[model samples]
Target chain A: MREFANKYGTVLVVGGEGEKCRDVAESYGFRDVITPGDIIKANAATAPFRALTESEIKNSRDLLARGGKLSDIVVEAVFVFADSRDWASDLQIMLDIAQSKGGRLETRSENFDEGPPIYFSHNDVLWSAAHEHVRLGMGALRKIVETVFEDVTGGRKLKTHAFGKPQVSTFEFATRLLQQWRATQHGLAESEPPETVYFVGDTPESDIKGTNAMNEKSKNEWYSILVKTGVYQAGTEPKHKPRKLVDTVLDAVNHGIRREMAKLGTRKDGKGRKLPLDDAALKAISEGRTPNFDLSVDPFAKAVAQ
Target chain B: MREFANKYGTVLVVGGEGEKCRDVAESYGFRDVITPGDIIKANAATAPFRALTESEIKNSRDLLARGGKLSDIVVEAVFVFADSRDWASDLQIMLDIAQSKGGRLETRSENFDEGPPIYFSHNDVLWSAAHEHVRLGMGALRKIVETVFEDVTGGRKLKTHAFGKPQVSTFEFATRLLQQWRATQHGLAESEPPETVYFVGDTPESDIKGTNAMNEKSKNEWYSILVKTGVYQAGTEPKHKPRKLVDTVLDAVNHGIRREMAKLGTRKDGKGRKLPLDDAALKAISEGRTPNFDLSVDPFAKAVAQ
Candidate 1:
């Protein structure tokens, strides 16, 4: 991602882990990372749409004492990467910023009645956790905030952006990241990008739909293969059909290799070259190992701080 | 309303002022009343979904020391009459009660995923209060609780009752009250109830829509009169049209008297008999006098504490 941004332009990142995400992004050589909390802390000096009251000043002092930053904040967009840890405070601050005058706190905008466009990276309403029941995810929180916003604005339409699974943005980002890696690591020419990419996953809705949507927009083709190891059980019908159904990732890999070789016109005696899954890779697969395909724009150290 | 309740049967009341409203209703001869706060205080024993913590015990001791009552609480329904003074605590208790097993404190229901039906009497998101900008009203707080509930339930449909202003429930209740008043105070038989009622108000949506909906269902008729003394201003389109638009409540009364007299075939020389508006009534209307329509089952003394 760092190389991709360097090659193309700057990459703007946002996350839910407050300052930790920002720090991690910075460590990975990616600039411009922020959270709603950062925006609120920056606006602490001017809040409640007037000269700061004594109590407001005292609260600001306390927040500064507890390690808040002061800066001139201007928000062009908001991208939510995960479920907010402090939803009440985050929602309050975001609403304030969205309703402020040109993103200035303590000042009412001429167009303060309308909220700004919001984006979330994922659409999982409930995610499995260690608890007995599923925990509320970003999608659920988004619904709550949307409902509150609608109520506050007297049925004003709420405009938002949804990415990640079943959306094109995440897949596009991942594809760009892969191209960047190919160019920077393997010295591939920029003009000679891969013609097609295979997306293999166990979930039909997010993975398959995202891949298909990206394929519709991109010049490159995306072949989505559904595996039966995770959410997709063996006998269930998939919500979004993939290019092929496979029992495991190994089968997906073999299928992709043979198809690509055949496309390259490298068939010999009506057979294309196939890639064999090595013993180590088979053992890892048997042990429930899968490659970490998500390219990190941050470091593990910063994630640990959260 | 008290006479009406006495003649017809019983009436249950609820309010935002908790015990104060309850006391007022009792004083007015009402038999039952409940508030969201009362439900919370009653469930203080089973808070945070656990046994009473040490802090809880200490808080209970302090509340008792401060003249709080000690009584076993049982709640069949919750009604919000006005803006809650403490929304966080009120919401927490309400959610607990709604999720509790058979509404029992400290016991989780096997079917806890579905929340109880919540109701709010007013839907004014923001109202002119003793402040500069509008203060958050019962409607705004209700939206917050609803959002929280949806988030907790992972987008399960929210089942609720919204009364007051344009909703059928408040109008139905008011109509019943009027019927009871006619029977008890005027010695009118149940079969001789008024054929038509004149509902005079300044707010268009709440007053007019409620009357219109009630008229749709009732065998008798409801004539809505919009007045311009309060929320409704002159030269503005009303959300709900009224039978007569007037400058004041006096004009509304006159209009209703003339219309009803004509309906009774008592017009003489194309002129109908008029109801006299006495000096005191005129002065009261000019001075913006409105009856305290909110029936309180709680005590006035407790409301004063608030």
Candidate 2:
């Protein structure tokens, strides 16, 4: 998140019930807040968007039963940050905004068909909330859109761009960010470059595949370090193998930075830093509190079935 | 074929334009013949229905166009026996007729999204017609209906039932017929059941899988015998193992019946005396004339890719 906020400038965070998502981003210095409910209320009567309950059946007394829609809110970066409280309403609104004919929710076309891509931030289709049962998240919405798109297009497959755990995109993006950061901190200039970037992740699919594909296709060498502290557990030796294995995030980060520095002839970890990654830093990230909530999902065991 | 006609009682033989398709089926003892043009002449308003070509592109005027729909033809049993000369017309017409509610012609409905169970005698998808490239057959027409159905129905995947080689339905029907024939030919009563119905085919997937599945699941047994002279080659080993490998149909038939007799308490070929599957007759069925048509675009292969 330190890297995220720095590189991407002031980001407007969206989606969350009454600012839970907004507050998390603001705490990380995002400095902006916008919610879908706010948008729907601010502009009514044309967006063709309406909110509904978790269950799909029409409710007589629902707020949206009286026909109104949202005005599109402009945000350069958007994320479907949390499990939606209302399934139909959020789906209708999010889909409306995402596919809003060049981003004007008030001016929507009257057809149920292919639409713009939604950047859902989390992969967990079901997560344990305060309730006894697991709650549905962005993944569930993603699956719904996928099915709906296909259904509307008469058997044509849905086109989507997804980037959470197990997807190659986010890890690749993160690695590129790390490469620039590591080189600048180590005083590497145009004439020099960092030799390697070690990706320390717990999931085998995304982390391992990212590193493997990176190793296969790029000049920025990355070593994969799979940690046992998160998504992947003991006993399943997946088809792809990581460069190294570790038991915890602190050990992974410490070993990763040190190994790269040693290999690159750099004198320290990220310019004059004599210490390995700090225990407190690792603890914060591992507890799912370090990076801005929009940038990262719960790092503990997420049921990312989608 | 004899059993199919008897079981169906009335097989409408279509596709012989100006007597070619009809000539072929009549030679095979199919008496009823109906061509598409005959229907349109009975109703002049739809004379344009016959104006379809196999490839209905705007500039395929050189491809002989047929004029008429399948709507006028009454068929208790259907055997689209040969490669279509004008697929666009045959396809549109057959599609219209098959989807007609309660088998009535000229009666339209919104639910053209599905059709009743239909059978094709030959499962040839593409075959050489003395042309340099493979030409379209009834299989191609079937595919067109499927594509259109998917396009109009909100992209719901169309579940079509097709017959011909490689579709288990056709082979299952054929094998059942063979078993009944065998039981009656032998002294076995209708109460006495089939032991094994050996299929000697030049194709691997249709013959091999059909025999294997039927053997595994049916009370009557099935064994696949591959011949090198047709769809399969001598050096090829099918993905699914056949019960026996033989270079010629004659050899396969001889082997299967002998093996069956060997299973019974007899060293004889069981000819004429209450059991007529002799070595000579087995050789005759195996040595019968095989057509020049292709049966290689097997449904099992299609299913595997799907």
Candidate 3:
């Protein structure tokens, strides 16, 4: 992922407590980062939409203290890489940018009601949390806020676009990212034919189905690898078997690329260089420097802290 | 109802803590009343199950001193008129009778596993209580106990049955009670052709639908009157509009009888003297003799006591 970002020149990942998102944005060498909490921390009227918990109040105060707030910033595009802990707040902030008068957060538009489509990464309605029952995801949260937005905006249909696993767009995005990453390590030039891209994912629903869905659409040679770590645990049968089921992510990353490369050796358009993770995925995800969880992005978290 | 009850052979009603259900059962002249609390007061664990509340414990002690203990007289039948407040302790006492190998509470059921069905008026799975959104009802509690019985019997189904608004047996039983009351009050008899019975009640789903369902099979014509006094308040649409909608129970009974008599005219085979509820229906459900409550019979006047 970092390799893809590095090859693309810059990456803008938006979400989290505005401070954390900003910090992440800075660490990743993005021109800027924004969070909804940053705006609410700057202003108070919008903060009372719900009863603020103590942590959220604290996050608000801390944001103001740091003086890194919602200011003018122009972003080309974004990767909604993960779930927003408080989608309502983050959504409001993101929507703020997507609809700003001149495609900027600071500027206002009389037509701000209709703006850029929200690029939601996933559409999972249910997710396993640290509880016996499943917790709701962005889809459900989107509903609650959509109702709020409808009342706030007098029944306007909010438009959104999304990408991420299981859903074809996210899979497409990931695959494209992989292609760029692979090409860069091997020093491939523009107008070059795309190489075979094999994706390894833990959950069958997200990883295998996503890759399959991607494979069905794309002309690029693709292989799917299923890992047994993150989402899919033992004791349950895999819903769909991939090319070869493996035990761990590390094993998958190592074995999957090797097998694909071996096959590639026989029918190669060009020779390849071995591109390894080498803590690069981790470093880029950490935004090219230290990742600080203390930089919590959710207003609710700050409300609770205070 | 009591007048009508005394007019007929005395019906004996029993069980439930204090005299709540007993009063209701007795309102229809179920003369001989008994409860496990009465038995427990005399011989602490003369039953199989043992559970009690603090107030019930004190009340039992008081009743013990007063000698209102379980009587030796045989009751013709038992009608659990409402939810049992002291379910575990009450269930223990009721089961003890069957366990006794005889009808006596003093005896133990050597073959209590093959006991009689403890009749309940309603088997609603859930009910509204003030503190919580929903609470478990006698139906759910019965399910739990029956689970115990199944385990004890190595998977034999408990001979458990329920009564009340939605349940057929209870409605049939109530219809019989009403028919008997009508007979004595109007000098009519079972020999007369069956009359159209109009049941006035709130709760469209239960009263209206149940009556409609029973109307499909029975010889008696069915007329329904839905009231807005209790269970259902005003301003909401009735799910099922009855034959005549009224504001109060008295209005319903008056309107129902008049409509039925008008529909039949002065020359009908099931004809009898006027069933003047203005004078008598009000008398049957009089505020003076009965404790004021939406439901939950009170023999000792606990809730309405000032």
Which of 2 and 3 is the better model by TM-score? 3
On lDDT, who's better, 1 or 3? Answer: 1
CA-based DockQ, model 3: 0.02
Q: What is the TM-score of chain A alone in each candidate?
A: 0.58, 0.52, 0.48
* Candidate lDDT (C-alpha), each: 0.56, 0.51, 0.52
Q: Report the C-alpha displacement of residue B212, candidate 1, in angstroms.
A: 1.9
Candidate 3 residues lying further than 4 Å off, grouped into runs, are: A1-122, A125-165, A175-197, A229-241, A264-270, A274-306, B1-207, B217-222, B225-254, B263-265, B268-270, B275-306
- The worst-scoring run of ten residues by lDDT in candidate 2 chain B lies at B56-65
lDDT comparing candidate 3 with the true structure: 0.52
Report the error of model 2 at residue B4, Å.
12
If scored against the real structure, what TM-score would every candidate get? Answer: 0.51, 0.33, 0.38
| Higher-DockQ candidate of 1 and 3 | 1
lDDT of 3 at B117: 45
- Higher-ranked by DockQ: 2 or 3: 3
> Which scores higher on lDDT, 2 or 3?
3
* DockQ ranking, best first: 1, 3, 2
